[model samples]
Target: MQVYKAFFKIIQKNRGQILIYLVVFMVLALLLTNTYNPPQDTDFSKVKVNIAFINNDSDSQLVAGLKTYLDENANLVDLPDDTQKLQDALFFREVEYILRVPAGFTEAMLSGQNVQLEKTTVPDSTSNVYMDLLINKYLNTAQTYTTYLPGLSQADLTQYLARDLAEQSEVTLISNGSHSANAEKSGYYFNYLSYSMFAILILGVSSVMLVFNDTDLKRRNLCSPIRSATINFQMILGNLSFAILTWLVLISASFVMYGSFMFTPPGMLLLLNSFVFTLAALSISYLIGNLVKSRGAMSAVANVFALGTSFISGVFVPQELLGDNVLTIASFTPTYWYIKANNEIAAAVSFNADTLQSIFTSMVLVLAFGVAVLAVTLVLIKQRRVEA
Candidate 1:
């Protein structure tokens, strides 16, 4: 009880550092949520291209139909035929495409001869390519109709083509039990939350260990009536209590931020995954605390482990953007599994064997890592005691 109480007192003394990390976690969560808010539903069918057209063809039904098609698909703007004016419009992005229907365009189409329309635009323009595709589709449909429906008069042909081209088909998109908008946001929030957990656990536990490792305090504790094993057990219990408190605080914050969504299956899985990762983090911190002798050295180790793993494991940058080589290296760290599991949970629509298997695999790996590090910590502690 004395050792446990003393351990907690050390943690209480470092509460300011712990509180700073907590505050940072909440602030970052809010900032990321606002910055990456999901886009609202939009009507894409009404989108139009901005274009400038130069129609030099004579009065003919075919040319008239082409003019109508261009007007319907694009926002037609009038600009003078002056070279400088056209160049200025192109340079300023006032129009995506500048099209010229030459004088013989109508005659060539009517006579069944292939003719190419001239287009002018700035270099490497993506909108220009899209506009070009639309133009080609309209002209190709008109040409095919003229070739097959030769019996129709010019006016009827033009009217039929216009009606046919104007028709639009409706499309509906459906989700197959995958993640929702809220789930995606939650994933990102938790991915970043790992950094806070790592820093708090390492700094908190290492600070306690530093106080216990004091030579005078250690000699006094050895002279006391308490068994060394009993003292060690109490210290372990205290560390576990501190870790649980930190985990609960973070988990509660997530629930407050996300509401009932945190109770969903995917959400629960995210929490569970984070819990496993927390255990791994605790074990690693314990190992570090045992190895490092000074508070300054402990702080340096905490910063390196926390920030370095966070950046490499996709907490700071998305996993999708990380290079394969970087991911390959990050795979050795627990944060990688933590983020990977969160991603899988966020993307899954329903809980199934496959989902369970994948998540469990990561959980087992995290646990394994914790157990391995804990074993090493115990061995090192035993070796140090023997040396003493």
Candidate 2:
């Protein structure tokens, strides 16, 4: 009990470092929440742009029909037939494009003569590109009709063009049949747990270990009446208590941000993956604590390992975008498997054998990593005891 109390007393002295990591994690969580909106799906819609039509030619059935077509596809703005107004309209973005049908434009098309229609728009305008396509679509279809059916009247051509262009096939967006959006949002939050948990656990655990490993302190503990086993058990309990509380704080914050998403099946799996990773983080902290003799060395090792592994393990960047050589090395680390599991959980909608096995296998691998590191740390500690 005394050792357990002492373990936390050492941590209280180092609370500033923990608060820094906690605040950083909170900022990161807020950013992730903003970035991962649930309604990522957007429906397809035809883009319509505002445009002005100038008919320099007398009204004819063909020109009238073309104007009608443009009206349907775009917002036709009316401006005074003045040069300044037109230029100002274009500059101010009130109109993205303008079409000027020159006199005798209809006659040129029926007689197989090419007439370039005057146009105005800003340079490199994307809306104008779509407008060009629309204009070309109508004229090109008109040209085809006149070439093959020269006897066809302008009225017939317009009628046929409308009918041909009117037919459209069905368009829709496909979905993954589950709460993929929510899963994705939660996934990002969990994926970020790696770096935060690693840094916090390392600094907290190692600092306490360093204090307890002080030579004068260790000699006093060894000579005390209390059994060594009780001290060791209390120390282990204190460390576990600290680690679990850290994990709970992070989980509670997520619950506040994401609500019941933290309790959903996939969300629960995300929690499980992160919990296993927390264990892995604890093991590494234990190992580093036993090895590093100074606070400065502990801080350096914590940052280097936490940031370096996060970079290679798909925390800062996705594993897919990382170089193959980098991934080959990262695969050796437990964080890589943890991230892989998070991604899989986000994409998954069902708990079929294949999906469950995939997620569980990743958890097992991460747990195995923690077990291996913890075993090594224990071995090192035992060797030190024998030497003493």
What tens digits encode model 2's per-residue C-alpha lDDT throughout 1-388? 8999999998999999888888988899899888765764566678789999999988888898888888989999998778899999999999989889999999998886776899999889888899999899889999998888887898898899888877778877675466656687778888888888999999999999999899899999999998999999999998899999899988778888878777888888998889899989999899999999899999899899999999999998988899999998998999999999999898886778899998899999999999999999999999999998
Task: Give the Å shift of residue 237 in candidate 1.
Answer: 2.3
Tell me the tens digit of each residue's lDDT in model 1 across 307-375. 999999999998999999999999999999899999899878887898899989988898898999999
User: Between which residue pairs do clashes occur in model 1?
Assistant: 177-349, 178-349
The top-ranked prediction according to TM-score is 1
Evaluated at residue 117, the lDDT of candidate 2 is 90
Regions more than 4 Å wrong, model 1:
27-45, 146-153, 176-185, 213-229, 343-361, 385-388
- Tally clashing residue pairs in candidate 1: 2
Give candidate 1's error at residue 5 in angstroms: 3.1
Whole-model lDDT, candidate 2? 0.89
